[model samples]
Target: MSPYKGNRKINIPISIFVVVFAFILLVIPTSGNTEQLITLDKQKLPHKFSIAAPEIRPLVYIDKQGNIAGQFITMFEHFSEQTGIKVDIKVMPWGRAVQQAKSGNSDAIMPALYTNERAAFFAYPSEPLVIFSGSVVLQHRQDTRKIDSWHDIHDSQIVKVRSMNLGENVGRLFVNNRNELVEVVRIVDGLQMLQHKRVDYVVMDALIASSLIEELKLQDEIKVIVHPEESRLSNSYLAFSTSFAAQFDVEKIMALINQYNDPDKYIKQLEIYSH
Candidate 1:
């Protein structure tokens, strides 16, 4: 013990040196290392962006051929190419797609109108995808209600597709009047009701109304009138869920959206598919 006690003092410094050397070896990535620290760093980054949208025609929908097709699809494809970020777009029922975004089960939802309620669950860019207005659809000869303003229809029977967020775009009063408001499952049903004289008018987005009229061949039966000047124009956005926002650089994505959000470009794209 006496002989080894002298060596123990020297061994203390050696042990310290060994610990420091081992730590350096563990931290410093080597060219021959398969599990390189740089590789781990790369794994921490996101590879692709996911988006969800409703089956709304001419905007985003599944065509008769069972493929996702629309202006929004083309826009996202361009975005993917511009940013080098892969995009996975899924088309589903409007209500289900919105619910999934609200619950953060999906990365993003497109063609969303901005609202304080929605802002709670999603992060919207200042740039808008499209600027549009809503219109009141009436039967050709059955309904003769004059909508000089939004309130003009307060006393008339008004129907809209269920789960449509028109109230946020128009106002609470647009959908809050129990006496006049009726919710239906589809825009086609609302138009049918108006055509059959069951409802006086149907409120819907102008672009959507145009598309549906052409699709259902109801142009002869239904007429669309834009909301009065007092009504504010609504802007649609490609909104990301809050959880997805936390994972990606939302500001960069928004910057890219602003760069490409040209009114003329979108109008041309829509016109290409318009009947």
Candidate 2:
């Protein structure tokens, strides 16, 4: 027997494939919602991710353009461009920002100071994303009782950003009056309160406070009360919600951060924006 040339077989009609494809198109949306969505695919799609942070001036803030702009935001934006993971930044009060992470409403929080209290709720990367010095406690220039040392703070009323841990330990020890160590929601609010003599001193980073003071035109009024003996060196890390940490690889994210984060340049950008 020779080779038999055969053409007769089950002819899968192209119309069937067309019908299946049309069904898929209806079942799945190509893009309808977010600006970052590459596709609305189910099995193969990249999911949207978000982060929250306190509006700490110069480091993380809502710029004059009403857009979230700062060091950490810039770093994540670069990461998003490289990795296709959309990073949404929510700038809120420090307390609410922490709450956002704890409740898993935000995927992560960044530039957060490490605390045993916070460690209980947020998962931090092994290394810090930012290390900064020059914490300052401000007093109005007119009220000018010198505060060059911890001894100088005396019985003065001071304001601390509530839900923030930096220098709070010392405040508890030094501030004899419980009511004297007032708490505020935002740093800008604290500075403004200090401006109006609502509080005698408002504690924050010297550089950050200066920028905000200039913006509010309170530069001439509020003066930094420096105490090198009580100088604070802070380390801030990218922290994720417990569930979100489990979802992503922490080391990979940290590597991306290290690649993109530049503190010196970030400061320059802040200066540019201030001008």
Candidate 3:
């Protein structure tokens, strides 16, 4: 119980405490040196939705450069600028592309024409992106058949890519009238089929058909029929992956469409791509 002995015991405990503190200091990071790591899930992962042009109509999907068209690039740029979101673009054949969206393979499908039949597999945004028109195409110099009325085309066997609802009304009419329609997997196949007398005619959009004619270098053989106004169509929102529908900025996408879809803007993009 002497003072010196008591002081020595206190000193021993102090030394042990200091040693333990030093060990901890050496092993663990200081507040200044600590770092944080963060990760995101697939849906939260940064990505831009993409859609495809049907294989039957290459021009809608393909460009002069033999890639997806300028329209898509323009669309992406506008949407990105409007929504502050980045997107990845893909152009696939129509049926396959729709299937991709339905299967959760792609985030979205593009330039989709609105039809009740497509509703079961996709999620449509609230805005209409563009209006497109459809027409019938045939050989330029052949004995071209007249389509002054639907009656003229009733008995004629028409060629179209399988699964395209060009004009739902027209389609319903054809179904009601019992018309003969041939389905082809590719637009080129349908064109070739028509050229070789396999079908009486091929139906397609004016822009797309012209693009295909120029693309295939078959200007001498193919031409589009624009009159009689058999069908008028418009595509609303890009079809979303049904599985991923809740993940995207649906309102922002609609806002994007409203902001940049001017006729002048489209023309300027087209002109730039032409060069």
Candidate 4:
């Protein structure tokens, strides 16, 4: 034992110091690498985005508690949650809403039906948010004339909401004649005119017509006429203003919308709000 101890008494303190130095070397780089990884992950997230939507009912409207609420609103909220985008909806008249979006005062307008004129100012998504069918709403009476197509009702006194771009041909038909194609301020006004026999028919979205008829308790007074031969399906979409489209990733936004735009999901949202 004495002979072995002659090899310079091993420094216990030096051994402990060496072990600690090796541990520090290993842990220091690991800690630095972990911090760098966290920073890189944070950089991968997308920036927040905001949008503007009109005050249209069923699609977009103010709830009883004065909150922006509707089927589209629910969809937009879900979109925000998925993409980390912040959507701020402003409820205003459709005309003003369009103007705001066009002037870049707002980032976007939702539920916009496609038209060549609107395309100049906004970028539309390839997939539509909802597909709406147009119908001719008329008073329920025994002597009501049958309407098979737009040509059949062309000469009749037909009323529609003003400034509504139904389509190029339809818009021309309505605006070209002021008397035969009466432009009302509201859907209710058009319905009232039909009820009073002031107008032969009121051209409106079938979904809105049904909802309005039920809400107004005019089930017995008003009826929706379907024209199978006429193509009346309109696709509504979330359109971004030209300026906003230039700055943001429009394709990415559209991709998210198309991914989650489910009819069953909308139905569930409508049912929840109905209750």
TM agreement with the true structure for every prediction:
0.67, 0.73, 0.63, 0.67
Q: Comparing candidate 1 with candidate 2, which one achieves the higher TM-score?
A: 2
Candidate 3 local lDDT, residue 172: 47
lDDT of all the models against the reference?
Answer: 0.66, 0.69, 0.60, 0.65
Candidate 2 lDDT trough over 10 residues, lowest sum: 266-275
| Ranking according to lDDT, highest score first | 2, 1, 4, 3
Candidate 3 lDDT over residue span 132-174, tens digit each: 5555445434636655454455666777776566565457436
Clashing pairs in 1: none
Task: Write the residue-wise lDDT of candidate 1 on 203-252 in tens digits.
Answer: 77666776777788776667655545413556778898888887766666
Better of 2 and 4 by lDDT: 2
- In angstroms, how far off is 38's CA in candidate 3? 14
Cα error of candidate 1 at position 236, Å = 2.0
Instruction: For residues 1-275, write the lDDT of model 4, one tens digit per residue.
Output: 56664457555778889899999987777765566556534643224545566555566777669888777778778877765556788877678878989998988887788888889999986777777654444544533576544555555687877635565445544565632777775567787888887777777666666666777777767665554532356677778888878876676667666676763333211111110
Q: Quote the positional error of residue 60 for candidate 2 in Å.
A: 2.3
Question: By the lDDT metric, which is better: model 2 or model 3?
Answer: 2
Which candidate has the top score in lDDT? 2
Residue pairs in collision within model 4:
none
Clashing pairs in 2: none
